[model samples]
Target: MEETEQKVGMLGSGSWATAMIKMLGDNQKKKKVLWWIRKEEDLNYVRTYKHNPTYLSAVELRIEPKNLFTDARDVIRQSDIVVLNTPSAYLKAALHGVGAEDFKGKLVVTAIKGIIPDENLIVGSYLSKVYGIPAENIVVIGGPCHAEEVSSEKLSYLTIAAKDTVKAERVASLLRNRYINTVLSTDVYGVEYGAVLKNIYALAGGICHGLGFGDNFMSVLVSNAIREMETCLTAIDPEADRDINASAYLGDLLVTAYSQFSRNRTFGHMIGKGYTVQSAQLEMNMVAEGYYASACIHNIIQQYDLELPICNMVYQILYNKQSANLEVNNLASKLS
Candidate 1:
């Protein structure tokens, strides 16, 4: 297929989805991009106003009116590549009527940063098992990049991982631009697991910050978080050669743990300030992926008998209702 003729579809409508659309718009080769938004009102609003109504409202949309859709299956059926950018918790629900047959021959890319709640599977594994997509065709997008920064065209780096390096490069080509630098890797398992684990660590960082821990402590916490991440990633994919120091791993962790735009950290901050898990979730307009990830990773640790102290602490505070002060203080003693 010709590069210009390859049709790409985006599933979900959120800040990250908006950012992807903006990136595709900047692609000099592709003229139009397909977008699937769940709500009729949102679809109409974007078509009329050329911008997402609720998220990333300031960025102007460049997609054609005919390309916007409310039906996910239709978009999947028509496009060669489908990008899944929905929150991990809602991913299954969003694809309600879509099935394995619908995903055949399509290149699936997941921009979701959290693991599937009950399944304990990352997006790539979930799609491969449930939707019957080939493992090589599944791509995972990881970042040191935030959607807010992408919207403003700020310089950002994205790591694209697949078992097939050639396919990984193709997807990277579609997303690369002057401001968006792309790096390709074949460590899909490591990249996906690292992405999921970082959010949990970011929450731990936020909780500490909200409790009045200074920059010095945060540096130590994040350093320990990277060690925790390396251990978890190695357990999941021992054969995949990966650098724990790469932007995909350490840089992503640092950004989420420190950035004002990190919803996971914000969610954690609220928890440290004495809010209940339900209350923190209710108050925020966005989904804090770490909240769901904490439970998922906690389950994985139990199954694998892994010693991930930071993940355990976040899980205790969020799921077990242990006080953040008490749990985090205990966590502090264990961190080097």
Candidate 2:
């Protein structure tokens, strides 16, 4: 198939998925971009209104009405490249009826930044192991980019990592625009794991903020968080040769830890401000990837016996019924 003739499909109807649609619509090549929205209401709304009514409503969609779909299998069958942008906790449900055969010979790109809950595997690894997709055919998208900023056309950077550089570059080409810059890498393991770990650190930052910790303390907390992230990523894939300070790793951490649009930070702030886990989740009305990640990472790290104090503190507060004030205060003592 010709490069320009290859069809691309987006799976998910959230803010990030909306942002990706906007990016692809802006691509000069103008390839067909198929979108799989989980809800019939959202699909009808986007087709009728040219915008996602619930998420990133302000970004006008340029998708052709014929390309929007409510069926996952139909979208998967029609597109040569499929981008999975759902929250990691809901990914299994999103692909409920999708089987290995549906993904055969297609390139799968993951924009999810959290680990698959019970499996404790990153998206790229999970897809390869469960769906029979080859590692070389999977691409992972990492961001210092937020959906809100992308919707507003603010400048942002993205890292596309895959075992195959050619595939990574091809995917990057589809997303690069005037406001979006792309960098390509071969460290799929490090990029995906870094994306997952950063959310946990962001939650820690939010908890500290809710507890009234100052900017001075935040600096130390994040510095240590990056080091902790490096420790964990290295343990997972020591041969990756990735730079922890790059946009995909440290930059992503900074944005999620401080951005007003960061749902994870918002969720953590709610928890720190005396709301119970149930109450915080109820009020946010969004999935804080870090909340699910806290437990998954806590479980994964046990096998490595790594010291991830920030992740541990978050897990305690959210899952173990520990006091946020007490847990964050104790965490402060350990930070250098």
Give, for candidate 1, the lowest lDDT window spanning 10 residues: 24-33
Every model: Cα RMSD to truth: 1.2, 1.2
TM-score of each: 0.98, 0.98
Clashing pairs in 2: none
Best by lDDT: 2
Instruction: Give per-residue lDDT, candidate 1, residue 320.
Output: 86
* TM-score between candidate 1 and the true structure: 0.98
Whole-model Cα lDDT of every candidate shown, in order: 0.91, 0.91
Q: Residue-wise lDDT of candidate 1 within 1-336, one digit each (tens)?
A: 765567899999999999999998887765447999989999999999999999999999889999999999999999998999999989999899999999999999999998888787888889988888999889999999999999999999999998888989878888899899999998898888888899999999889988889899999999999999998888877888899999999999999999999999998999888888899999999999888888878877988789999999999998888888998889889999
Per-residue error (Å), model 1, residue 302:
1.9
